[model samples]
Target: MARSGKDTDKRIKTGRGRTASQIRWLERQLNDPYVKQAKADRYRSRAAYKLIELDEKFGLLQNASRVVDLGIAPGGWAQVVRKKRPKAGIVGIDLLEVEPIEGVTILQMDFMDDAAPDALTEALDGPPDLVLSDMAANTVGHKQTDHLRTMGLVETAVDFAVQTLEPGGAFVAKVLAGGTDNELLKLLKANFTSVKHAKPPASRKGSSEWYVVAKGFKGRD
Candidate 1:
């Protein structure tokens, strides 16, 4: 729908040497209401609205004391978390450097590294009450390959959540449209009281991304 640009309220003029896909993306960004709202609200990215919608539906940030944000680039979700739970300690990790947020501890490194879990835990005063992962593997274009790579990140995030979340805590991670695999679902059901998938209104209809929310951790023992 955004490709034509002419039909939208805002037009993205095609720039020189821009590929068709890039032109379409610019058109979509220009036409997207969330992008305009994000600018007005001063949120880092439109992804912030996804977390806000999820929080409203699920109460994910309620009573949270410490939070861990995976793939926290651009810091939109963390900003939301900080605003919703002002006193909560936040530790965020990403491969890219994020501009500092006042009360957050940011680690710039590979979250898949062996030391990452300890690093994140140590940054916070105690085990996290909420673990959020917005990580997605770099897409290689092949659908199956992309799905597996993203699922791999989800699986690892689950493992970290199970290992580090306090009892009764919650874990939320981005997953593909079909949602978590059967094995992952079984693992989540076994470890948490409830698990569900959600696609917030902020997520574009064309996007395959959905969130897997696993709540009420049963403890690691």
Candidate 2:
């Protein structure tokens, strides 16, 4: 709940821990491969690799598809989507401004805005073939508050998907690891052919984040 102080000195001494653990508290950026690859490819976040891994496992990104990316501030996922489909429709929305990336329509607005989804639809001309929501709230000192904020975002994203996802479309979003989002999980199973929870290799080991992917959307009333 409170930030992990499991490694606190005097409180918890090292007992022949692994090399990474030994120097973890003082570690600097020592060329994490995902970071290197992101720099090399000029993607926004090293988190791009998580999307790549998910795609490799599920082939979610398809040619000629329309995609909406929520909380795409750093734009790594947008970069991957554009590279994967040079001619596909891509719209990325975030609270912060982003330098333009080719083939993406960037909207500098909060996804929580009432008009946001409408604006996104206007940009896309219709429902999206895929919706990728990497939205995470800035954490407060309180873990329960942070979790609630994160779950709120996830719930909103799922509602948006239910309304605007095309039949057989996919919804991918970030979730916390302490508990599976129960109501969202149930909704996904009812409406999609498959719903899976995955923790990609690119996610930080210490982070509680994971991805929930619901695919093969069944159109709703």
Candidate 3:
């Protein structure tokens, strides 16, 4: 592949049996500034910057006492939380095994399991003031199927947040580009004082992901 006139661009040589898609992915990763920054900062993944940007814009981590991280794989978001709010109780659940992060309680289990919510709450001393969900269903290639599955996870995360968050709390979850569906948007608006969607600069321009941030949790009436 030819460089687009950038002297610093890194190129990946495609070896035997490597698909074009794999080569493109590697090339993009090699050229991504965030990926380089992540290595320099010792963060687990580039996704950490997405949360950092969101926190800067929303003030989500300030004075947070308890937090729940849904789909906290590779522990990047958890690491950010530990750094920003060192004394906060943080519990994370994911199907993938995450190497231990000090001050974070990791549960290597599916967040959709019926018992998962209870386990998360038990790990914390009080209701979570900040609930973060980066969960997205594994893509199955079909666009509609992938979108539906991801939205299902977001809806469930919203339900969990409504049922578990403390008053004046905040919930942040990744939603697709078209933003939350009408029903989900209604639910969030009804339950939160402010609901807005944002795509941080850290998110790739080609990606369709946007984050739905709902703040000021209304207590269960």
Candidate 4:
């Protein structure tokens, strides 16, 4: 494969006490444009560009007042939300401890915890106008198991969004290769006026991840 001009000739030296996989990861990170851009922008991770691209296409952050971020470790997505919606009340939950960001609330806990939903809403002080889930299960190296676990996170995120999003609000979640399954797709379509899948430009070409953007919440019956 031909390397892009942006990659230059940067290469990692082998035998640095790093395993082959770790060395490959480091080299890819070194050559990734998004990583460079993230450093320049002072965002926490390259994943921030995924949200930025999604927002540019979906307008997810423009009118948001209260927002919830699921799996907000490293605080990249939350940082983007704070930058774009400066006044939006942002609360995030994750099993990983995150360094705090100004104008954002960080909760170190599992979102699957029974108390999570209440804690998130309480922190926001209102139903969120936008809910973003970047959560992915820790991969177990078994493809089927990994996909199922990640989808479980997506399912929970969708349930929370449907239960608490303000009318006409939006929900965005990371889904795997097949996107939402039939039942989850039906639930999203039934609850929101628009449900679509997108792979933002920032997403790596080899990745199976996609974003489900559901907008115009129809409100509870």
Q: Estimate each model's TM-score.
A: 0.95, 0.86, 0.96, 0.96
Candidate 1 collision pairs: none
Q: Model 2 over residues 1-221: C-alpha lDDT tens digits? A: 02233442332235465475555632423335566567777888788988999998888896438999999989999999998988779998999989999889999999999999999988987789899999999999698899999999999999998899999899999999854577778988999999999998888888799899889999987
lDDT of 4: 0.93
Can you write out model 3's per-residue Cα lDDT over 1-221, one digit (the tens) per residue? 12244548777765568888888888899888888778877889999999999999999998798999999998889999999999999999999999999999999999889999899999987899999999999999898999999999999999999999999999999988799999999999999999999999999999999999999998899
Residue-by-residue lDDT tens digits, candidate 1, 76-159 = 999999998999999999999999998999999999999999999999979999999999999999999999999999999999
The whole-model C-alpha lDDT of candidate 1 against the native structure comes to 0.93
The ten-residue window of minimal lDDT in model 4 covers 1-10
TM match of model 2 to true structure: 0.86
Query: What is the TM-score (0 to 1) of candidate 3?
Result: 0.96
- Candidate 2 stretches with Cα past 4 Å from truth are 1-28
Give me candidate 4's TM-score against the actual structure: 0.96
Q: Which residue pairs of candidate 2 clash?
A: none
lDDT of 2 at 132: 96
Q: lDDT, candidate 1, residue 208? A: 98
